[model samples]
Target: MTTDRAMRDTDRMERPAPPAPEPLPRPVLDSHVHLDIVGSDGAGASPEAQVEAARAVGVDRLVQVGIDVESSRWGITVAEKNPAVVATVALHPNDGPRLADLDAALAEISAMAEHERCRGIGETGLDFFRTTGPAELAAQERSFRAHIAIAKRVGKPLVIHDRDAHADVLRVLDDEGAPETVVLHCFSGDADFAAECVRRGYVLSFAGTVTFKNAVGLREAARLTPLTQLLVETDAPFLTPTPHRGAPNASYLIPLTMRALAEVKEVPLADLCDAISATGDRVFGPWP
Candidate 1:
């Protein structure tokens, strides 16, 4: 599967910017985002500006997710200054193969994960989509288990990034014993997988991709997820929703995705908003 950042970069060259959708009746939280990447869209938007834009559109709260050491620390810094934002620090599944010292990077991530503003440890899990060898796969699994340990030790939610390696992800979690709270970021599974995750007491955080016309399977998964186990995110500047497909995305665009999710779940939009907000607080704890 193509990474969201790669899609965002190519989409930047090929599509027009998406117009913001109607604001939600009740505010909601974006459970996962990469403000560092969103801020680098060459549009010159700062992290603060992005947060402001999200708030303007009823995305009042957000989780700034980190995929590497620099982005993790940067996310913490952004969270420190922005009350609307909390952060998650971790080494992404893809990061293990690139880091010169994986252990050292994980150590820094471990230290940073303890920060008061850091509410989760992840974007870490298996990614079979990009790995080219067994060694790389082993490294990702090793890092994933270590991150599970960190999240457990810190008593924060474990946010997982499962990409084309769903079974392996579940295996690793079972092996290490999952943290009390677990979130499957950008949940990309069918109904069976969704049922499995839900059975394991994991929350599934849907992103803008759920709004895509071809995302029938994803929509099915969304329909099956209970409100208490549901969360929403942009994963910006990627996975821009329908009528704006292939365009750069941001938190301000989440109402479109939220509305799509509401339609899929056959729930009132306002109710979905309230549920997602409640789920956010439950998964990440109260934001300051």
Candidate 2:
């Protein structure tokens, strides 16, 4: 018998043995993932298979974010081919030097934003955590400013990737007249910073760090931030939530992070799901 036919037969037998109720769906929207990395092998299941795995765990949509010009183009191409995926194009803070001609890079990003499947501008911002020199920091700042300019010019939300440079990031964003909707993606700051972002009408996106045993500060921020201002992401093939920590990350791990957030906020999982999904929709524009 065909696979579908076998599943039907098994369902029929299981139904008679004991009235099996439907399984509760996993409520999640993995706001970020790196399908290009996951699909690089192009052999086995593929990144598309990863999407299927995520779907099995209740993730309905994912934003495929690009870290450089080539990755941005690949992200857009993937989104165009997959209805469940949306693309965000920008040079990551660490990739600042690669974009020597800021204007030309911005032009390319802007063009990608115009694509029907492209949803936002970023995964961009400052990363003091990784800068090697004053020159590197300056380059990162220049690239960040360029990204903000593009976000303003395109009138789309900005996805920020601040790491150990919260003050500088905030300062630059303020100086640039903050984009329409700013998201501190994978927020790892303290409650005060979260409050500051909330005060500025920026969204705070939580990642797997919230699930770490040593992440008291992140958990506090998760608890303190208003539900409407909170967002969630995988930042995967990177920050895998606990139980799966150090494993190859994917959108499928979002529930583990969400469960941690739900606990932090003292809210039911379903309610937390609704609030975060709504926040993501508001910030990114309705999923395509």
Question: Global lDDT of each model?
Answer: 0.86, 0.76
lDDT of 2 at 210: 89
Where does model 1 exceed 4 Å of error? 1-15, 39-44
1-288 in candidate 2: lDDT tens per residue? 001111222222222111111222445688877776642221113667767767777787888887778889988888878777888998888777545686687678878876767788888898876578988888889889988988888788898988889999999998988988888889989989988999998988888888999999999888889998888887765666776565556676677888888889998888888888787777765766
C-alpha lDDT of residue 209 in model 1: 83
Worst window of 10 by summed lDDT in candidate 1: 1-10
How does candidate 1 fare on TM-score? 0.95
User: What does the lDDT come to for candidate 1?
Assistant: 0.86
What's each prediction's TM-score?
0.95, 0.87
Q: Which stretches of candidate 2 lie over 4 Å from their true place?
A: 1-26, 39-45
lDDT of the structure predicted as candidate 2 = 0.76
